[model samples]
Target: MFFTEMWERFSFYGLRPLLTLFMVAAVTQGGWGWDRSEVGAIVGIYASCVYLASLPGGWIADKLLGLRRAVLYGGALISLGHLTIGISGLVEHKLPFFLGLIFIVLGTGLLKPNISAMVGDLYPEGGARQDAGFSIFYMGINIGALIGQFITGFLGEKIGWHWGFSAAGIAMFLGLIQFWLMSPKTLANIGSEPSRHPDPAIQAKQQAQVKLFTGIGLALLALVVILVATGVLTINAPIVGTYLAYALIAIAFAYFAYLFIFGGLSTDEKKRVVVIAVLFIFAAIFWSAFEQTPTALNLFAYDFTDRMVGGFEIPATWFQIINSAFIILLAPVIAGFWTFLGRRNVNLSSPVKFAIGLGFAALSFLIMIFAANVVIGGGGIRVSPMWLITFYFFITLGELFISPVGLSSMTTLSPKRFVGQIMGIWFIASALGNLIGGLVAGNVDPEKLELMPKLFTTTTLFLGGAAVLLVILAVPIARMMKERKGADQPIDPTQEVPDLPKE
Candidate 1:
């Protein structure tokens, strides 16, 4: 399961780095010849759609198809989407490009949430096995990401964009096959038996979540299309960034209100939910900025950096590899560091980890700040590739500290019955952040950049402020997150993936 997932991610992320460049590249360069803002809009919208779709995907797994079918469907859609995109440029059709992007977005939405849910399903409730499994799975995520950079970045830049993209499509196709073959032998095969998602029971639950999420997503997309047609909104009004953020907040609140206020959760679980929601708000913000590496930051690499290295020019696509590479290298070390801390009787709570993570994030931007100075010479200068590498190093460290641990915490904290809904809410926070990240990128005034300092001072300042806020909340949130009688653990000890459908 892990390897299959990794392959799909490799395909997805491997293609990610090339997207902005593909959009803005000169027609002579086999691109659309769009401007930076135009490219940013496309990337942002694509990202927002992918994250936003997870809610319905997870709900479907919980209530209707179970984990296995959800994953199969998601993989098929993603494969189809990528294939479409691969052939999109063949005819030089802009609408084809947009349609291909939409397909990929929908496919991702269906796949991501359910896959992680399956991991949780594999684990027993609050068991050591589940914890270890998730960590290992996360490591696989980085591994796939690392390999993707080499394959996607290298192939996309060297052979043209479609080749890398087609490779991703092929990977998705294989992943679908791999999962199908493995299901009967895997825990997922056993867990998703008729007794687990009972035809009538889960089917009803899934119907509601799916109905709500799909209705909203489709409604928003319709508005976007209509407004764009009528000139009320640009093709990228909020760059998919703004709406994504808001949509997450909407999901979070709606679910929380429904579950706690009306749905009959215990007081302890409700309190935990409140606390988790606050934490999720921060998650949304953190990811929104960090996610820019592929969209806004990719543009930064293309326009700002000089790509020469020792008489050979580095492909701009290579920059995307840095984060994945950092994750691949650092994840094991970080996991070990946590274990070491645990053995030393010095466990850091999730909130403290978040603070520490935010602190680490400051390092990424600070590196970027210095890189800006590296270009300080009066004329055009590119920072050494090492700078971007180090920047990703910092970001990766922070992500390791917060992302998985926080996810584990949410599953641990949530009421068992609504785990799927809570996970969807958590994902919603990411949606918000991603949307904001796009908005920030879209609003970046390239001309005003000359009026300001070379360093991304505004962005840096915002991140710095967020880091400080996280630092302040570390202790309180930690205190609040302490387990209350441990009654909330899931059914199987394999809490690793929290039993959502396969993505």
Candidate 2:
């Protein structure tokens, strides 16, 4: 599971540093020369769809293909997707690029959740060993991220973007081969079969709904393709993207409402679900601020930060490594600190941790505000690279606080029957965050340099305001959580199932 996810993340992170840069670069430089707004819309839609697909992916694993087969099929599709992306270099056409992204989004939806599920299956009776396994797995993910960002980012910028993409493809294929060879022995019988409720009537109704929804989805896809072909619409057109973004937020709200009002949950369960919904909103806010690393922050590194050290100028993509490096170094420290605090009987509920996360995230942007000020104060002069490093350090700490805690809360708070659904909601919230974050990134202007400081300041306030709101509601949320759980419950020894391979 660890190695499989490591390589998957290697491919995913490998793409992150290059996507916007490739899109917005000039055609003369082997890019499509898209505008920042267009790039943002495209990236946001792509990212959002990747997470949204997880809902169906979980269903497929439970009702149809099973985890082992889903992982295998998903891995194959991912490899093929990267191959198509690499082919975009040869053809210089957008078709391959777009198709490649679609394949990857679908593949990831199938692979990501199932692999983590497999990790849980590794220890049927969970204990400290389960937590330790996940720690090892999480470490593998960061290691892959560091390598991907360092190697792929360098290759994409210094060599050719396609070469970097192809490297990621190769790495994924290698991981796939490793998994296939070893799984028969190591993961035998685990996640090998589907797990569905044994009720013919329920199964029949589910199948019907799946068919209906799938048909509608296909019809919508056809309509969009037709519109694009006829020049009636373009992918990621600003006005269209704005509507889509609003639609996503509405969908999130409506889904939660449906669950709350009509899902027939117990009173206590509904309260817990409400808590999940609140955390979902906060999670979206946190991700919106954190996920800027590869988009807005990457651009900042390229266009604003001074990278020269003595004589050699550092690669802008190399700056992407800082967050991953910090995660790798600091994750264990944070975990140990949490355990230390736990032993001391210091209660840090998820909401409080989330608030802390938001605060730290705001602090990161505040650091950027300082960096932006330095540039403006120096009359549009670039600032030191140390500014970006410090920014990453703060955000990584913020991530440590919020991301893991939120995942744990999702599992603990959810009724067992709806745990998968709640997990899907968590991913969707991240999708929403990435979409909004991309919109924020789209507002960044290289021409109007003075906006940099203002932009960072605005982000600072937004995230800080969210932190304040979470803090204000922390007591109530904690009370809700404690109502369902025992006051002196045994410590849960299992680590969180990761949302993505990254954290």
Candidate 3:
């Protein structure tokens, strides 16, 4: 599972740095030559959809395919997606490129949440041990990311964009092979069957509902694709993105309302859900700022930062490795720190940790504000690479505070049957963040260099303010979490499944 996730992330992060750069590069340089805004809209939409797909992906795992099968199928699709993208480099048409991205989004949706759920399943006695396990899992993610960025950045920038993309596909293929060989032995019975009600009648009804909804959703999606393909339904990418963001927010709210009003949950379970909801907002905010790395910040590195050292120009994409590199170095230390605190019963609540994470994220942008000002004053002079290196460092610190910890918390707090869905919701927060970040990146026009500082300042203020708000509410939220019934009891794997409430 660790290697599977590593290879998957390698494919993802490897492709990420190349996306905007490939679009914006000159046609002669083997790129699409699109404007920053168009690229931003496309990238943002693609990135957000990658995470957004997790919702349905989680549903499929819960109701249809088990977690294990989902990961297998998702990996295959991702590999195919990358292959299609690589082929696009040889062809002149855009169809293959777009199709490839869609495949990847769907694949990630299935693999991401379910795999994390499986990791949680490994340690049913959830506590500091689970947190440490997630932290270790996170290291696999960054290790892949660090190596992927380096290899793909070099291949894309120094060789060809398609070559970099193809490399990602190959990595995923390798991981899939490893998983196919080892999973049955390592996983045994874990995640082997779909989650279902104990009553056969209820299970059958649930399956029927899933099939009906799935068919409807697919039909609608197909219709949109056909219309777009025929050019009969021309769409503005940015406008569509804006509406999608609004729709996502509405969907999240509706889902939570259902959970609170209709779902069969205990009072303590509801409290935990409420905490998740509150943290969701702040998590989205943090991601919006943090996710800028592939868009706004990537462009900044290419256009304004000094990449020259000893007559060698560093690839702009190479800068992305900094975050993953830091994660590899610091993850163990942080994981141990959390364990140490747990031993002493000096644990900081998830909300408090989220606040601290937001603060670091704010500080990261604060540094960028200074760097942007340098560009404004230098009048075409590129700033030092140290600016970006430092920015990534602080943001990485913030990520450690939120990401792995949040993953552990989700698995711990969720009702057993809803684990996959809750994990999906966690990624949904990331989806929202990526959407906003992409839109924000659209405003990062090099043509209007003066706006850079303003953009950074706005981001800084938003993060800082969110941090303050979370800090103020942290204590009450912590208290709510403590109210969980039998909070310290180990969850029984054989507990009777509750029937899902009818809509």
User: Highest TM-score, which number?
Assistant: 3
Candidate that would win on lDDT: 3
- The C-alpha local distance difference test score for the whole of candidate 3 amounts to 0.84
Candidate order, TM-score descending: 3, 2, 1
Q: Write the per-residue lDDT of candidate 1 for residues 224-330, one digit (tens) a residue.
A: 75676567876444444455556667777787778778868777777677767767766765686687778766766766677877797677777877776777667
Model 3, 1-503: lDDT tens digits are 98999999999999977998999899999898987877887898999999999989999999988999989999999999999998887887787898899989989999999999998899887655665566667767888898999999999999988989999999999988888899999999898899989999999998898889979987887788788888988878788889989988987898888988888998867877887788788888898898899989999999888899899899999999998888777666676776677578665777888898899999999999999888888875788999999999899889888776667667877888888888888888889888877777766666888788889999999999999999899877755544453645434211111111000
Residue pairs in candidate 2 whose N, alpha carbon or C atoms collide under 3 angstroms: none
Q: Ten-residue segment with the worst summed lDDT in candidate 3?
A: 494-503
lDDT (Cα) of model 1? 0.67
For model 2, the superposed segments whose C-alpha errors exceed 4 Å read 124-129, 215-219, 226-232, 486-502
Query: Sort by lDDT, best first: what order?
Result: 3, 2, 1
TM-score of each: 0.87, 0.92, 0.95
Q: Which ten residues in a row have the lowest lDDT in candidate 2?
A: 492-501
